[model samples]
Target: MDRSPLWDTFKALPDTFLAYIYAEKTRLAMAEESRHVVNENQQIVAGFHHGYEASDDQYHPGTFQPFMMKGYWIPCSEGKLFQLRQGHCSITRTVEGQDQILYLVHPKSATLFAPLISKYQHTQVDVPALALSSFRTLLIALPAGGTTEFAMVKVSLNEEIGGVRRLLYQKECAASVANSSVLKNKQTEKFTCLEENLSFVPDAHLIDPKEEAVQLSGAGMIHRPVPELFTTQGHYIIPLYALFGINNWPLLNALIEQSQTTPTQFITGALLRPIAEEMVDHIYRQRFYLEFHGQNVLLKLTMDHNDLPAIDFIYRDMGGVNCRLGDVQLHQLPEHLRGHAQYWEPNFIPDAAVIMEGIAKKVLFNLTKVFFKSEPTTRDPEFCCWRAKMTVYGYQENWTLPGADGRTDNHRTRHTPKTFYRYGYFEKIFARELLEVMTRHGIFLNIKRSCPDYDYSFFMDKIGNIDSCNTPCVEFEWFSELVKMTLPHYFQHQDAYSRRKNISVVRP
Candidate 1:
């Protein structure tokens, strides 16, 4: 199909299962592609700035969730490439004052990505493209073509997103999936879960030293507890609130919903369908009520038994963080839900509206970079409306929640000072919004005719985290709905489209 999307996400599945999926998928055909952070244990180990050590295995202590650390870069000399054959990490100097984290990484041992710390022998240089911030720094590296250079580059990790690395993994998944054969049957679909929420582990999926084929690409596939398809995977976890804050993610709330069940094989895109052009306004009013430049909003793309196509919309962000639109009612919904729930989903309330105003006054115009390195120049045009409003920063990688976040450590959070994520109010907000959409824009499917044992309550309870987690509960409803609104159209589209094309049509 030549469908190499820029990103790939297979709902929620374990690392073990992912391996099998990858193998089967590769056997089918294809190619591939993928970053990192730091802390206290990192300083001591990297031999610079503050160090980080294993805090607790539960909080991803050893190789916890993808994270960030603020430390100085005590360079041995002025250089850009401090090649570390021992570990796989990168370094970025904070723009002037504001410290920003970048790339993605495995949550194994410390050194995820290095940040500019003061501990190094630094000689300032002017780099134009670098982000402007108070960290007044530029990446230090050896003046190449010499007796090779090495030092403990003050490496730090991004809280969870590990920026660049996260995107890389998504690229990998997209790459892997594009190679699948259209004729591949469901039984032979063989594909793995390329989850971004993995942890660090010793001797895990570390990349090789070959500079050309970035090894960091495979970092997310390490040290997680799951049954196989083999090949380990890892993730860049952060507060659920961070995920909810923007539109640059898969179904965040869906992740939580799926986690509520008995985890099975990893699966994604099996539930929801892609958004249609007609619903752009609906999605815009909801998802981009702010600015979801690259948000990944997904819809239910199946068809009805009568050969009709359907579309259902939901926020692609972690599942929360909507203020402008929470109060902005949906005129597109059926009359019943449009006016029935006068009280906006109790959870999607924009906390920033009230909580951040006072704090906004205290913002350091000079040290603003310390907090938002990229804010000074690339600040979103919409953000001015809030100053003009105000703001913030995902989920369980930091805390516990109702469904999935409850399994291992429901309350034992690793990061400090309970932000929106630790409390899970962010996800709470997204969940509420999703429910609102389902109530308003969602379609109905009579599962009783298809399967007498269909379970609506179970499916509604858990549908997004992973297909396994919620599939058993609502499979009938979903399938019934699938048959009723989208499947036939899907086949027709593929069939008609394929027939006129050169590819041969081989029905199973």
Candidate 2:
């Protein structure tokens, strides 16, 4: 129980942070008054007490152990001299004391902590020191209290991704439906990755020293406008992976859990933006660099998307058995030197790391207002970072195709597609299996008996009397029955595909 949460950080503030005045000292004093010191075995270490719910009839039905944050202790004051061996100020408060800490952390200042909270909730991992430091400017504000000397740190709400980012800024778009369409005026845009000094390093040679080697990183990115609106009368809309629903990706889910910088956790661009990212050089696992534009500075980070969340990836990069040339990521093979061992890593899933090439699509989504704690990486299992639980979905996209108007070079337009995008699954392999299971489940029997001579529509009249004087088919029950009967078999084939499959809900 004393273990720190994954993604939680107890780091010393950076030099730049000590000079930044992010909070008012007055507010800090108000927060400290809420604190109380209780005795634990004749010693004083801060703590909190609360009535936890446990029974179904009691409006609550769960057990809870109040978490204690891992905060650094500075005995030499001046906020310097971060003595690690000194002490840790935890959330271990008495009933009289709420989340008050060694010093008062502003309530609104809580925005800086959204990302750290989201990360811990999802994977139970404490973030690295650097991650938490990025948002330290918004952490607790020290108070020179009057009669009592107490530290009141912010009480993290343990909200989903939204709560994490809200600690840093104003309203977050992802957490609230009202803020969802905030960027209606901003149109999406696209940017391409400058060509890296691409050299087809021989299978037996590593990347040699070249001037361009400095530019070539472990990751790359391509940016483009968000996907054109799926709806009409469209305004600039934000895209979010969470909106992807059951048909989403493990990578997207992971991003929602990691990022605290922006409101992207749920706010996907109305259109898509293809972004290229670079990886850390020479790490066995893939690492990437993301550029975060802040008020005073711009920063780059080398990280693993699997380790951090909110990674912007192109869906087109993912290739399956049915992927097309235009629908894949275009990642040049790294200089493997020998046996191309790097290709065998997990980043090569869904075929290969093929970034999209030629007439491609791009989109954008953001998770606004998340503040993740980036602690130092350690082998300790309690605070070690990990990716979110992964799940793959395959479903046939039922959409219309755009007409060939050579002047208009866009697949996603205001008009509906006249046809569907045919890719990502093999009908021949699984369709037959579904047909057999469906037959065994007594589907064709009803069809055969109802319209043995003609198609099934004719028997609709026989199955039930149309309540209206001029209607053609049977009752709604007929439709529901058909759905319940065939859907199981249809999904069976669908579940087999890690990418895409059409449920045979099609009635001829």
Candidate 3:
């Protein structure tokens, strides 16, 4: 609970900034606390905790574990260090006498992996040092309400292809130092292989933390913006939006001024492109989906040789990622960690599609709304034009009046243009762009059937239902045609990019 070391790192920042972080953290904690309170009239919503509902009864009930309020300290090979409670289960520790950091997970706190840990009797699991370093660095760079320590020392680009860069950062951890006493006696089973790099971010689980034992967590390489990677020119990382308090408007303005690019170009190229590309690549190659909302995503801005802003993204919180199981080789995973249903999905396309929708609605759409100064909902001329287009495109039908017998009669039709305006121009545009991106990546939209036939009745029933509307159908059809026209060229470009960088082709 002693966060002095972490707080000291932010000494360069103003006290008001620290106060903002504290206020934000307190507000978030309060909000989470309120959400966890279930009234007597409310039903016990299963799997609501951390957005995961247990498919099996053996796991902890949904009513338990209220927002990771508890933090535990573990005795490791080096010694006992203070646990820095993050928003979730993971914590960071500084390695003494070395410039390194280790990310450790309290397995019990991670609901997804808790069953596996209990079944295997594992003591502790090691998160990727690089990933942890990246996570820690990102936390410092974009100080949210959680733990803050300058864990990352330096970051360097491991590889770069087609403007996307693979970053590597170093941090200091106590476990990274070799224990001569344990090494000489050959009792190294309790020590983790700190140097092993693997793909896939794991939900680390542990048992009996007081015991002196360390186990390697499920391993895999994760790509994207994380932690501390800086250039000699002092390039810094900032979140697309703050976790609390301030907004990204000023930052966006500064970035636009510095890059000398219009807001549209910067947003489309720097923000949307990276996110869409990463999502598509992850689904296609890695067989996983990321929650690329504002908080989980960060922007790495630096000046290029031409003084234009070179933008990259860093994604954190691997525990929330959903993996596709059917295509993923489970045999490649550790024996103990195999067959967990929480993270892996047999049919993952729907989940991935939903995540894409979230990015559009939660991240891009809101961002555009902020940038354009557009109203939340508009019933203006543009909206009317969009509705007309939807009707012409067969996504909406002419309104039919209800008959005296309380049935919809086809004979009597009325075109009463209802003032139902939930989407603005920017929202529609972003939705269409998202569909285009999905189409390019071979992900076509498949709207579920709320009614047997998706007809006028369906549209009427879902008039105000933003989540399920006919908008996607219209956009999908439009983009599908466009993609069809450019199918050959798209494949050619994709193949060329793959050939240009083989590693980038297969990486997330």
Candidate 4:
């Protein structure tokens, strides 16, 4: 018998290389098992079959009910494939005990998504290829490099969605990513740049031949699998969101503290400062906006001696990105980004002030506040607090004031007095306790305390000076009141609300 090509290659290589090939073969076998189509009618892929429970008794109250629905497994540039839903609803049945519940997907959502997916499949939308209708089925390409474990693990996570809670969690996260994208900074490449976040949608044409409306299955709908499984260089790196969310706080903290120095050093020295500086400079100097809220950010913790957390700062959705294209040097930007600017609708150009406000809202309020407030106990509350505090203050000193006067960059357009009047409230109380907390932490032992001298009154005056004819006093009051509700108090209110809701019976 003739020797196989793989065998011939193996024989020509060193003996050590055979072990790698053997491992590759093993991985391919597992992937083949996973991508196998279990139910031809439903297009149910295999491997996930192990997680399926035949009886409702086996499911957690929090798990989405298990049922087979029409879906597709779209392949990434890396050999991995993610299952996406077709014809609107991924889950097609009502819950067993709940008669009021009809379906997981709304009719309106499916109606809107169907045409979008079809258009992507047939036409070039300048969007990610996942929008295409033709990308279907978990096709396992043999001998593909890298461990299939992450892809399989993702599949398992999808499989374990057996309760309503799981469904809701997925829905909420997806919605958040979608909504946050609209708030991203749209500034051109002269001063700011961002990663485009994209989500998976089922090509109904490929997955649903009958073109029937997707019904809610007690078995939940499959969502687009995040392609973050593979890095830009094609390496696999797990995101910190998974560890933090999966109740692996210990692992996260341990990784943070693994170095000889404190968690603050690891965060500040290795990860935080560089990114913070870049963001602040761009926002303040160029008036380019961003929404780097934690969910959109991914952190990769190394188990090696280096103790590095490789931060993949991804801004996936483009809808919220606000920027002044006229101020940007478009030629300096890469090709795809150039396409983004060229393809953008002409009317969507936001005012310079609006982009600055977006930075304060998304980056400062949403990212910094939420992180420090929610996970205060994750590391030493002191460390998280300082890091968060410093981040806010650094932005103000380095970017905010400088950008107001065009001091950050000579080429950048400075914020006009009118623009300052609109956005001054943000500068006034940004990270309200940051300076006070820094003093207490002794982080300012050598540095002079300048918070007292900072002109809070000027910003306050700007706020009051706004003409009430166009900008209502009520609107300014609402903004002030909203900012006053700091993250800690906001979360406290949420906890109280949740406690009240969770109390099934109360005695009078």
Ranking of candidates on lDDT, top first? 3, 4, 1, 2
TM-score attained by model 1? 0.21
lDDT of each: 0.24, 0.21, 0.35, 0.30
- Model 2's C-alpha root-mean-square deviation from the true structure amounts to 26.7
TM-score of model 3 vs. true structure: 0.43
- The sequence of per-residue lDDT tens digits that candidate 1 reaches over residues 185-288 is 11211112221111221121223334223344332211111222122333221211222221212333334234442111111122211111212222222222
lDDT of candidate 4 over 51-152, digit per residue (tens): 223222312212212122122222222111112222222212223432110111222123333443353333221100111100111111112244221110
For model 2, the superposed segments whose C-alpha errors exceed 4 Å read 1-278, 282-508
Of candidates 4 and 3, the better by lDDT: 3
Model 1 CA deviation exceeding 4 Å by range:
1-127, 132-209, 212-426, 442-452, 459-508
| Winning model by lDDT | 3
Task: Kindly report which residue stretches of model 4 are placed more than 4 angstroms away from their true locations once superposed.
Answer: 1-248, 270-272, 285-287, 308-312, 327-508
Question: What lDDT score is found at residue 455 in candidate 3?
Answer: 27
Order the numbered candidates by TM-score, best leading. Answer: 3, 4, 1, 2
Q: Per-residue lDDT for 112 in model 2?
A: 35
Which is the better candidate, 2 or 4, if ranked by TM-score? 4
At residue 376, give the lDDT of candidate 4: 45
- What RMSD does model 3 have? 16.3
lDDT-best of 2 and 3: 3
Cα misplacement distance, residue 134 of candidate 4 (Å): 21
